[model samples]
Target: MTTPAAADPTPTTGRRAVGGMRALTLATAFAAASGYLVMLVAGRTLGPSDYPLFATYWGAFFALGGVANGLMQETTRAVRSARVGPAAVLPAPGTGGRVRLLPAGLMLGLVLACVVAVSAPAWPRLGLPAFSGVGVAVMAVGILGFSLQAATAGALSGTERWGLYAVLLTVDAALRLGVAGVAWWAGDAGLGFAFATVAGTVTWAVMIALSPATREALTRAVDVGRRRFWRNTASAMLASAGTAALVVGFPVFVTATVRESDPAPLVGAVILAITLTRAPLLVPLTSFQSAIIVYFVQRRELGPRALAGPLGLVTAVGLVGAGAAWL
Candidate 1:
């Protein structure tokens, strides 16, 4: 009787999990398709001679945004940990000296902005020949805004607000597509497209104003103390930074090193090919990264067994994708 009672909820739990995944899949697919469209617009508008530079700039911004991704991932873990039944849970957020994420995110954003400003003098030589001080300044502002988005995304993911998270993801991709289209229409050049790249970073602001739940999520506390949170964040950032280099920053590296007879078209072709090929694999994995982490955190008692299913799915998908590409 006890075993039967315990097993009764399994079907309902599986159904909920499947529903959440379907929603996430649709959202991420839209985001991925929007990205491909944005690339097409950039390539057509910027033309061959200039598209490579835009691609490189796009890559560089996302590479730096990897730092913000670290914040999001760490915040997700911390928030989830706090909510779970822990032996030493802190006080409810916004009381008893709990440390909220927004204030910390704002401070970090300011620090990142300062770093970008200080590094402005080297912009021209550092694969940013087309960028003036003003461009760098805009990038700094974008980075500051991105920190807010990261914090909000982490908060929503941690709190199991999957509907809102899917909305956030969809809105972000839509903004990018809309802004890039406007930029092309205005003939704003690579600089305008650069702005388009970071346009979605401020989506969190709108989300906060419109959604009371988002505002409330931001107040949630981390599982750890302030010092420990930052320490863990540092480690996460280092690992994410390495990933950013290999994944997003590869175009920039190829731009620098490849010595083709007609390098402009060659580099552009390589960048486009890489982007199109990698998107199918990387986008879904990245979009679901926070959810996967949360799932594992919830099932930590299951040990390594928790990983087998997701790992097998990824492997099977990779094999199918590889075979498709080969044919």
Candidate 2:
């Protein structure tokens, strides 16, 4: 017979879940707002004539980072499943062997960095006159930094360390905003904004150094073996690449399709409009991906029925958003 106190633990657990959700929501809101502000600052600082250059470069950087984002997603699932035991989707880590995901992600990031560097000479032909070898070098460093961030973020999410996860999200966005603000105040243009775009990738390192829990998360092992992890990561990257093309990379396409004969201000305005209009609807949802994945994984025993509530909520939100847009 279960004691009443034991049976009542669900209430406490529910409360904690609610609290964590609030924290995550606040952190996501801050990130979205900060991103919008960064775009605004970039436009003002770079002005109309040069803003398109920065916009195009920004789009390209994120499109490439989609690969890293894919790593993060799989890491989240792999780590969460490992922690949740054998009943979950992915296999659990064991005494037989453990593969640290961060190191693997870093190696992959290095390979990507090399590829980017080797391809730098071709960037100008793709419409980025400013991205010579130096720009590519900066991008390589940013990719490496982001790979570190993605692995750490996945570990944190898998362990259900929502506090640290929220902090990670908040700090990354805040740092980017601060750097952009500094660039704006200093009157630096496209190059400075490029640095700002990639600046937050170092947040994971700082978090790991300051928080012992973050450091401990780095030790968390994924469920899959190395080869399987890489294969899964490649599939995730392909999906994320498509997402990146539709989301951030749309600006790159828009910039590219605009001929030199097109007016510069018009191009910049269209890019900015697309960014601002779409971000509010998408950024928070994207930021919550790990959390959603974790939620569904925990409830996998409930099967497909578990998705009903979230799907309904998303539908409601989408309808409201569409109506607002129409108005």
Instruction: Give all candidates' CA lDDT scores.
Output: 0.79, 0.79
The alpha-carbon deviation from the true structure for residue 2 of candidate 1, after best TM-score superposition, in angstroms, is 30
Candidate 2 runs further than 4 Å off: 1-15, 85-97
* Stretches of candidate 1 exceeding 4 Å from the true structure: 1-19, 86-88, 91-97, 258-262
Best by TM-score: 2
Instruction: Write out the backbone clash pairs for model 1.
Output: none
Q: Model 2, poorest ten-residue lDDT window?
A: 1-10
Assess the local accuracy of residue 189 in candidate 1 as a C-alpha lDDT between 0 and 100. 79
Q: How close to the true structure is residue 296 of candidate 1, measured as C-alpha lDDT?
A: 83
lDDT of 2 by residue, 170-230 (tens): 9999998998999999998667787888899899889988999888777766667666777
Positional deviation of 226 in candidate 1, in angstroms? 0.4
List, residue by residue over 196-223, the lDDT tens digit for candidate 1. 8888888999899999988988987667
